[model samples]
Target chain A: MSQESQPEKTQTANFEERLQNSADQIETTLRSLLTDAPRGTEQLRPPKLLAAMQHGVLNGGKRIRPFLIVEVARMLGYDQAGVLRAASALECVHCYSLIHDDLPAMDDDDLRRGKPTVHVAFDEATAILAGDSLLTLAFDILADEATHQKAEVRAALVLGLAQNAGIGGMAGGQSLDIEAEGRDRTEAEIRQMQAMKTGALLRYACEAGAILAEASAKEQAAVTRFGTIIGLAFQLADDLLDVTATSAQLGKTAGKDLQSHKATLVSLNGVDATRETLNSLILEAEETLAPFANKADVLIATARFIANRQH
Target chain B: MSQESQPEKTQTANFEERLQNSADQIETTLRSLLTDAPRGTEQLRPPKLLAAMQHGVLNGGKRIRPFLIVEVARMLGYDQAGVLRAASALECVHCYSLIHDDLPAMDDDDLRRGKPTVHVAFDEATAILAGDSLLTLAFDILADEATHQKAEVRAALVLGLAQNAGIGGMAGGQSLDIEAEGRDRTEAEIRQMQAMKTGALLRYACEAGAILAEASAKEQAAVTRFGTIIGLAFQLADDLLDVTATSAQLGKTAGKDLQSHKATLVSLNGVDATRETLNSLILEAEETLAPFANKADVLIATARFIANRQH
Candidate 1:
């Protein structure tokens, strides 16, 4: 109501608008990439495979990882078209992970983003095929000459993506998480698992932006550090939300960690302590961008947004 | 014995020796690539995940695919170390496909190469993750500088691999294969499905070798044509064996295509006619390598080996 509060409200509102706009862009690009791309001269893709892939990717999500990629690229002055495809590739990997993680053998969740999970919407076989296609398509998109003008850059992107998504990264982390279910683990062990399971891809998104911009090693390292801190914050906020947010608000099953006896930061430190840690991590993330100062306003805001998000 | 029979026996002996030698090299290279690679600090891969992946890949079948990659690369005069990693990458993709295709949702097979299938040996979830890790690891190997001296070549290899392995290629073909179960399909339709499924990767392996060698476009096309014909031959041979070989010989469930009512070249044309067609295809494959003359001997031998194998 007061003048001082007005600008802060507008800033938050602006970030929301930016996030929505980026998601829209990603949706359009992803649709065309998935459906229209020629598999060969015959165009022999199974209609059902395409349907399952679209079902998993097209409907809804925050697109936060892609937004980071685009924002960081924008901050470094890369063309929108050049980076959008790359960002979309990252989203494909993310969507694939979610699809697989939600399978009956894994999380066994039925709801995602307020709708049926891919396996529930389609059959499990179709869901598995769809996930595989999406992951493969991510690399195909990056390898396209359209993603970047430099071959080295494209190679770097592919390499970075494969690293984060493979064993010792997201997939490896998921394996650890699965093993840790209903078991006790130290906080350090939990951090490592979370870092691989979720944090790896997030870090890669920022690193990809840096690669796109051809930033200096020093500058890339800074953005990467920023990415890592926010990645931890993102996990902390997610754990906090698991206990605090409702199923309706989260668009996924709520209180899952507690129900499944999954180890998490909130379980280890309790909610109030976890919140304090998340706040400090957000500040730490913001400080990592100090060299960029005004140019990094959106990124700093992104760190806070990640921490404070209710869903 | 006649004097002329001496050279014929020697040729067969030489081909057998060459095949064994190539398989040995591939097995050694694949083991090193899978076990020693540092994905990130501390080599944090879960033991089960690693176990599943290695079980799917190692101590396995003939290693025919990797042999093709290495032989083709050698035929084009590339260094063994430079091309072997790339060859191994393709084999990883092949192994991943086998692992997933054997899942209960897909072919529901319990055996592969006389050992329990990955899903049977491990749990279903670990098998899925292992397949995923292997697929991701393939791209990682290709993107590494060790695969090729030229970054452009590496990018091209990654793009080509993704294209063949994704929806328009192996996955698409698989979708069709799954849909075709218990259904009749025209010969043309069967060919198309086979081409996309198994044929695509075989084609990619040869094309990859050409790409690595920086061969002329015309030369690449010739090798690619050779790959296509052999891919067809490979499928025909497989279909024939499904009917003729015992489960022990095939190292998988025998007569599965018949039991599942899956369409195949043999199913459509009958065994006698299918064998004739396979022979013709092998000849066609050999003719495509005419440009290389004596340099093509190993490839020609490989084509015959594929068509004539009992298992």
Candidate 2:
């Protein structure tokens, strides 16, 4: 029994190490991107705004979105500097959303990732501008010659990101979620909100990998399906953690969603049903990547990690 | 004397008509873009969010930035539908900045262009999201094949827009301006702040025209210089108006800059000197376009009109 469990333990350790390594690489890349003005521009980085952007983004987190991009691209046989650069761009969008989400007019959180939020660390105006800058920087990174040799790939990435992150995607989802507060939301409405607010970026993370890899339509569709399933699983796991975890564990204000009467799948369905749904999502995500066989092991592990993560 | 002034009057009327026609076209394009989801996307435009975006963007303004793109591109002999589309994208970035700058945490203005600001009309959260969505949509429009058939041009627009709108440009400039409030500023600091905050996008507006027309580097440089000089003129006129014009004429609050102790060239150099400076700027702008001869008559007129306008 001890020998049998040893191999599982080794796999878990290996997965965690890979996740940590990716997060560290992303952190380094993001730090450089935020610190330097892009080459050949006379634009001077305003120190205050730059500091606020650094604070909002450089704070430690799991870097799950970037990890997905890197791992999926690797699985698709396209491991290049551009892949990490594209990953960093997606992470910028994610960080910018978090900064805006924590504003006084939004979630009103003071702490994120165990530190004062950007608004608290700097000021609300600075925070807003920082978020704006980061969002703009994401496109700047994607459109650069460094992101891809082919301008077509770069343009496609820009369009995809703007579509997912703009009016009908993340921002739209945020509007729906804010409006949903203090009102009983139908399950579909809640699901749609969650999909937009969180799932869109997650799905884009995977789609970007396919785009960077120049994957065939069939392979791209498979990876995108995997992304969609994991996106749902990620949100379900988050809902569960919000109900079950503490602020200390989550590094944020937990249970505030309940206090705000925010609707979630966990609130609509019982804990048991939600857990069951998460488990099924994990299976579906695994099945979606089955054609890749062992090449998709990292992504399969990533899905399980997202579904079972404590924070 | 009446006969001598007749052609000048006619030219003025022609310029005004051209400006108005461009503004009307921009209004139509913006309304359509905001109303419909982009083709081939599963994304849904949330109704409340969409309404806020339309309100923020469709509020009447001069549409000066779009006009610059169209006029400059036309002057360079590349009038096309893509020019107007790129113009609309620049307008989106401009409108988004206005929305954010008016938020309670920023400039805290209640009125814009004689209408309630987005934050005042919709809630602050919605306003923030609307601004974000519009900003994101700008890149989306630029990246589309409709904006430019050449992927290189599309990518260049995206990169230019991002650089001009990001930390070192408009958003960074906003941070500097906000930080400078209630404090004395040196002439150079104020100039740098204004350049970043307002000058960057205006410069991009002209450069985008050169880019769209595929002008020579020298011609692009000439247009960019013209843009820079006119950008200074635009701001100087704005500062002059803030001191001289009534809210009824300006369509927004006036004298608020003085009330907030905001630093400006008009505040530093006094009205007479600032007026002198504005005249010199107009001359420099006209000289910058001298190589284009009569082809630049409209733009030369635009510089004069910008400096001499009452509001």
Candidate 3:
């Protein structure tokens, strides 16, 4: 564990070579999926709202949620288009969350993906509507478009995503997060807040794909387990990076959780110990996927990506 | 028109009389449903988040959204508990919206339904999470507990509500609303904003019942139309009241919109003319329900309640 060996640049290249194709496949579709993606040529007004929405969703980001969504779709043997559509819909919700989260009342971050946050880029009100429209458009995608799959499965997957993203889940977690500020919370309470705030939707991004595939109860359980672990590990890594990574490296504001003094894994456990815990958790997650070894590589790669990435 | 006798006291009494019972009904279940709402609660650990969730949702004001939801369900010939349960989820979302809407960044209203806004009642961060949690809990209800319906139907309904409530529908409308302050938006734009802000969710409530009934395409279309008209007309009437009524009369606050210079029909049209337009819309809505003349008095009465009410 001597500074974790930085992947030796060549090994990093090799790892990118191994996973870059799949990652690139996801990235390309993500870019196109939002390119002037109008709701339709219908008479739906609010042209500016739509424009702001496109700006918010299309502003370049890693597209992590969609990548996971479509990866599960791909692992289940669906073609690129099918997965991309679902992935795009998920991206809409993800973008919506970020926009709302960036609102002055919420997390209040003014930059996203290395650019001005929606409110700052546009105006606060437009940013709000952009987020709202994106959210509604997400369901519209499932209901109106995102075809080729059974309506029922699409419906269930969309619903699951909504469930995880909403009040009792991610948004609620965020609320608790705001509440936790400047207050000493028990570790269990802190974990619960993080679980809801970050973990819930992250978990759903993985589970939604399996749900779309109509994966079996056993497969569903496995993916959920995988989702839960990745979600927590993802948050912890995020916490660690907030402490260790610079704003330039992380591509967003860093040390925010500490600035806010909100309870977080890093705040709960010191950075070095959190690093050890995160590494061990990654190993544990690998074990969780051992049963589906061949199909689990991307999922495994994603976990490692979150755990070890500089950003 | 000479103020049309101002409906004196009877209008409110009648409107309140119509919605009061349902409000009472929703209130009765408020505690039990939220506390023990979701059936399979065993696996949820620590339960504080859900408890905080229950804290946010339970024991609230008049259940206008649920009233509409259940009214629509009953209008279609079923008073099933399942429908009410499904409707209840929307109430949670609506409550969350109100809570968030009252936040400092949004409307910044300190009072909601004659009570302190969630943020005022709770901490700002807690209020954010409370609203966020309530929003998420809505979808979770349908996904986790509404065990009576087909997964597809449930998913569609849940997705519909979540999407509408989030960015594109309610939240988007609010953004436009916040932006349009003092900007002199046209009548059409004001109506469109109102439709999205207020009408979208109401429309979903009506549509949700239809989806649950597995209503025929034509019937669904008809119900959707009914919902659209009602939703629009309701907002129109509400705008009219904001001008005509005072804060005490309205039970929370009034004239806030006018004070903010937010565009409204009354703002565009003179007071008397706005009242006429609102009436015409109401008449059109009540007439639309004639096709379902024999189904449920509750629906007709509900329509009349909105069309002909004061406060």
What DockQ do you compute for every candidate structure? 0.67, 0.77, 0.28
Model 2 alpha-carbon miss at residue A290, Å: 1.6
- Per-candidate chain B TM: 0.95, 0.97, 0.87
Ranking according to TM-score, highest score first: 2, 1, 3
List the lowest-lDDT window of 10 residues for candidate 3 chain B.
B37-46
Model 1, A1-311: lDDT tens digits are 66476998888888999899989999998888877457433236788889889989997688999999998887887765879999999999999999999999888889889888889998888888889989999999898899998999999999999989998799999998888887899998999998999899999999999999999999899999988897899999999999999988998789988988888889889999999998889878878898988999989889989999999
Q: Pull out the clashing pairs in model 2.
A: none
Off by over 4 Å in 3: A1-11, A14-48, A76-80, A142-148, A183-190, A256-272, B1-18, B29-33, B36-61, B144-148, B162-168
Off by over 4 Å in 2: A1-4, A36-39, B1-5
| Model 1 misplaced regions, further than 4 Å | A1-5, A36-43, B1-6, B40-43
- The CAPRI-style docking tier of model 3 reads acceptable
TM-score of each: 0.97, 0.98, 0.84
Q: What is the full ranking by DockQ, best candidate first? A: 2, 1, 3
Error of 1 at B202 (Å): 0.5
Residue B243, model 3: lDDT of: 84
Which 10-residue window of candidate 1 chain A scores lowest in summed lDDT? A36-45
Q: What's the distance in Å from true for residue A47, model 1? A: 0.5
Summarize candidate 2's per-residue lDDT along A185-303 as a digit string, tens digits: 99999889888889989999999999989999999999999988888999999999999999999999899878988888998897999999989998898889999999999999999
Task: After the best TM-score superposition of candidate 2, give how far the Cα of residue A74 lies from its true spot, in angstroms.
Answer: 1.2
Q: What is the lDDT of residue A100 in candidate 3?
A: 79
